[model samples]
Target chain A: MAVFKPATSNLLHIEVINAIINAIVSGELKPGDHIIEQHIAQEMQISRAPVREAIRELAAQDIIQFIPRKGAYVAPLDPRNIEGIYLLRSYLEGLAARLAAPRLTETDLNEMYLLNYQMGEASLKNNVDTFINLDLQFHDFICQHCEHSQLKKMIDGVQLQTKLFMNMSKWHLAAHSELHREMNAHEPILEALRARNQEEAEMKMREHIVMAGNRLLEYLVDNKSSKNSKKEDTETVKN
Target chain B: MAVFKPATSNLLHIEVINAIINAIVSGELKPGDHIIEQHIAQEMQISRAPVREAIRELAAQDIIQFIPRKGAYVAPLDPRNIEGIYLLRSYLEGLAARLAAPRLTETDLNEMYLLNYQMGEASLKNNVDTFINLDLQFHDFICQHCEHSQLKKMIDGVQLQTKLFMNMSKWHLAAHSELHREMNAHEPILEALRARNQEEAEMKMREHIVMAGNRLLEYLVDNKSSKNSKKEDTETVKN
Candidate 1:
């Protein structure tokens, strides 16, 4: 057995946390799946201590749930949770846009414009992952001009929560198309920001967030319905 | 070395986390104050494992910062962070009002009314702690009624980050008066919810959050200036 070591770096825990987060987001670690610390530790060639630390960290963020004497499990995406997250996202993104409006440099506008171009290219090439990445980057770029770390962190946390859902629907061409539409939506926001119209920027950002939420909800509902049908078919065949 | 006892209960970690969180919120553990795992473990009479787990958990939530090779410390509040948090809170609270407007029950209204009454009592008694607690409870009541768990969680997280700053200005009776005004401000929200007027409810909630942010900012500025003056006086005496 490997000897335990006092944690010299939070880096190990963070790395493990990120790995698990990515696994969940990528659907490799599905909701309700048990996470055995020993197994993970062995796989990663580390002590169970760091693995345990990572699991607890993720649990605190509601990304995972731990049951006493049982084990840690990935958290399921509850629709109610999604609704709450989206509501906050809309508000924060709106604020970010408003702040960026007055402070957006020419370089900021150019970067946004460039991001939109890259998004179009990704969409044409049918690269959903690239599209999603660019889309998030574009939003982050806009938020960067806001000069508000707390708002950015809040927004980042909410966005991270939504990433798994977003990734789950990545295979859908319609989702890609919706993302393209979202990219186009940024034009009005960019214009408003460039004009230093805080109200307009905020309004546009709110609308964008609302639209994004609706799109995701639509995808999730459809995905659930299809899943239910598949389960029903399996049950009928058993009968 | 204590042999690790399998966690008897998940509540232990949660309880420890809450204790640490309370300590931070009450200013018993100020920003940047190092958290010694062994010290807390000894005080709580738990093993180092659980304490470490609690620290990791809080660190994940960004309520605490863990530096590699250093140790865990209460996360410091930055003005920019505060600004971002308020922006997000305003939007989330606004959305909560909009959602709650359509679904609010009579019982919800009654609970809020009772809380408002208690807030008034607390303010009258000049109990800052009681008044602040009631103020938070009042807002939380609305959030709960809205039935958006994700939004509620996000809002609660932001609120936790700023609670220290809010408490710092207990000397400002105007802040207490503002809380009274805020309690009354809920009247419009209650009316809008009772009437199922989504727009009105959203408007009222947004205004209340904005006003609250403004009041907090004013208090922080005053506190900062006072501190600055004290520092300047100390420097002059030394010179």
Candidate 2:
């Protein structure tokens, strides 16, 4: 909780929000853990005002929750909510790809292919971190060419939500099959971009995201059912 | 400039942001007008810290622009940027309509129709303010049923951008033909929703937004060209 250093940034509240989000991603702040603004401020050697502002911003973003009189807590991940975010990502990124297709040059397409190839290698080597990073880069590269700042901004926000969830569930992508499936999903998108077919590119990009979301949803469902069965087994043993 | 009263809200930054936006929308703060933080703080009878935070927030949202060494000013409107916002709105509100169509009841359909009827009446009576307000309500009513909070949030944000531009250019919507077109666009959307035709509903909603956007774009182009012609005529007279 006291991991934050003194803040000297011009935008102290943004710094606080990023620090808190980093703490959550790094597992130092687990879901349902109370976020004491005064404690954070003291840890950062700053006044409590910025910390309070950060908490309010986080709550607005759905990354933190206020439980009435219970104060603020790291918001618990909901599979349904994550699915909604992914669906939004699918639509917006699909729009991005459509907008980017004609704008993307040969150099850009080659760079995307290079990133995809590296992602394939990383997947083979079980380098989930590198693979995940490259996947984001690939998608971001296309989004950057969309020529729509607001669209890119909305997509970035949606991607941040996905990033938080993925950090908490990296094991899902750790499976070799999942990694390969993820790597392969980019094929049609790249191909469509190569041909400058906006409609196909949009559809492929959307399908890729929908597939990824479905895989995560399946994992969540399976894990929950298995946990329920384990709990039943424990109750039987106790009986 | 000193229109704001003392702030009493716990989220003072938000209050400040809203005050600034209201001032802009009300034509008190025009585009390119410098935003003075200390002045705003003094006017609101609050400390400068929250006003500073509000400015930072506005800058992040693109409502304020920061020039190096010159501080912040209200962001100037760009027709192209507004067009992009409308395209994003088209896609997102289309999504909202699709998700909402299945969830909307018979009563909801009737209510939407009633609102549309009222909009027709308002448009005929040249009640631009009431017509505009009801148009937002009509869209918001459907969005409220979308069952996707994040999606709704994004739509609300996009709508806010559109709202700001609309406030600046109310003359565009005040035209009798434009008002009627705006009012009539809701008809097909309502019919599709009443039939629970998700695809048709989405398409109609998207078309409605695109049509509205095109109308606005036309007005902007016509206004700019007319201004140019006026300038040319003045220059000719001088010659």
Candidate 3:
């Protein structure tokens, strides 16, 4: 939090928001840490107004939460929330794929193809940041190109929460094997879209999301249980 | 909008927020209409601070929109938006049902049963207001009782959009037969929940929402095309 220096952008509020989001997503700002607008304003050498506005905007977007009388904090990730949001995202993104498939132009396909190629390369090179960036781009492209603005908004909300979950769990699929597996998951979805098969595109998209959610959820549960037992083990040793 | 009387509550901001929401859901506040903060404050015989805060809260919920320099306005309901939100709600509510089945106690089930009974009565009497309230209660109950706070937040958001859709469509499931059909749709979900059958509850809940969404979507499409052709007919007559 202390190290964060706001990057300059045309709109100070937006720039502040993005900087905080980047910080949170990168694990620099951990969950449950209070987000002080004044501190950020001072650090950025800007007025508190933009920083406050940025916090408000982020709060509205569910990336930050303000507790009554407690101030804003980076919201903690909950397994139940992750499960529910991922489930919802599966359906919404599925619909996005369906709507986007038939409407996709050659250029759109080319953009997606390029993104996929870069994602594969990043995965092979074990470049976690590049891989994650490409992954965000791939999903963002679908939401952008989708015909429904409301659907895109919903997907964006889900993605925000997904970032929180990923940050909390430190589950970026950093391992080569896991990254490779995830990279492959996007192909059938793209193929369905490229072939203009709306139903298949929708189904494949939903399947991919659900599969990934299940994998992450399983890991989360395992991690929690292991941590609990480790705490119990510590108690026994102390005793 | 003129008929609205502000409800007295401990928190002026919350009361104002609720009053506006009720007005919107009841169709007193039409879409695209500017919401005057000063007017609301004057009407409520309170200061504008609470009113402004209420508007900001509502804006955060996406139940209201604030345009830069243009002030806040009721966002128009788009059919595409409704389709997207309803799709998202279907998956989320389905998960809630699955998680809630085993957790639902005898009292919870009884409360739902009573609500369902009242809903049927409201429909039989063509009491649209009561029916709509009951419908909201029914969904709110599921979201509230769901184990996940985050999931509850998501469902609440979806419900907000659904309210906007319902208001925009003037859809109360008004017809006796349609109400009856919708009432029947809930029975299977209830039965599954009663039996603690998670899978069945989820499947039935999803089916019910999707069916309702399909009905609404069809009507929206039909209305749009008819409006378009009507415009064409008028143009032809003029020419």
TM-score of chain B, candidates 1 onward in order: 0.82, 0.85, 0.83
Regions more than 4 Å wrong, model 3: A1-12, A45-50, A79-81, A165-178, A217-239, B1-10, B41-53, B164-178, B214-239
How accurate locally is residue A5 in candidate 2, as Cα lDDT from 0 to 100? Answer: 80
List, residue by residue over A11-129, the lDDT tens digit for candidate 2: 88879988998888887776667788777888899999889778866765667886545689987677777777788889999999999999998999999999999999988888888
What is the overall TM-score of model 2 with all chains considered together?
0.88
- The two-chain DockQ for each candidate, comma-separated, is 0.55, 0.36, 0.26
Candidate 1 off by > 4 Å: A1-10, A66-69, A78-84, A174-183, A223-225, A229-239, B1-10, B79-81, B174-183, B228-239
The per-residue C-alpha lDDT of model 3 at residue B125 equals: 77
Q: List iRMS (one decimal) for every candidate.
A: 2.9, 2.6, 3.2
TM-score of chain A of each: 0.81, 0.85, 0.85
- Model 1 per-residue lDDT at B31: 75
Report the number of the highest-lDDT candidate: 2
Query: How would you order the candidates by DockQ, starting with the best?
Result: 1, 2, 3
Clashing pairs in model 3? none
Q: lDDT tens digits, residues A43-133, model 3?
A: 7888887787677667766788877557899876666667766777787788789889989999999999999999989888777678777
Instruction: State the lDDT of candidate 1 residue by residue for B1-239, as single tens digits.
Output: 22222334556776778888877776566676778887777666678887887887677667788887799988877654666567667777888888887787788788888887887777676777787788788778777777766567666766676576667666685444554554465677777877889998888888777777777777777678657522212211110
Two-way TM-score contest, 1 vs 3, winner:
1
DockQ of 3: 0.26
Q: Residues B83-141, candidate 3, lDDT per residue (tens digit)?
A: 66677678779878988998999999999999988988977776766776788888788
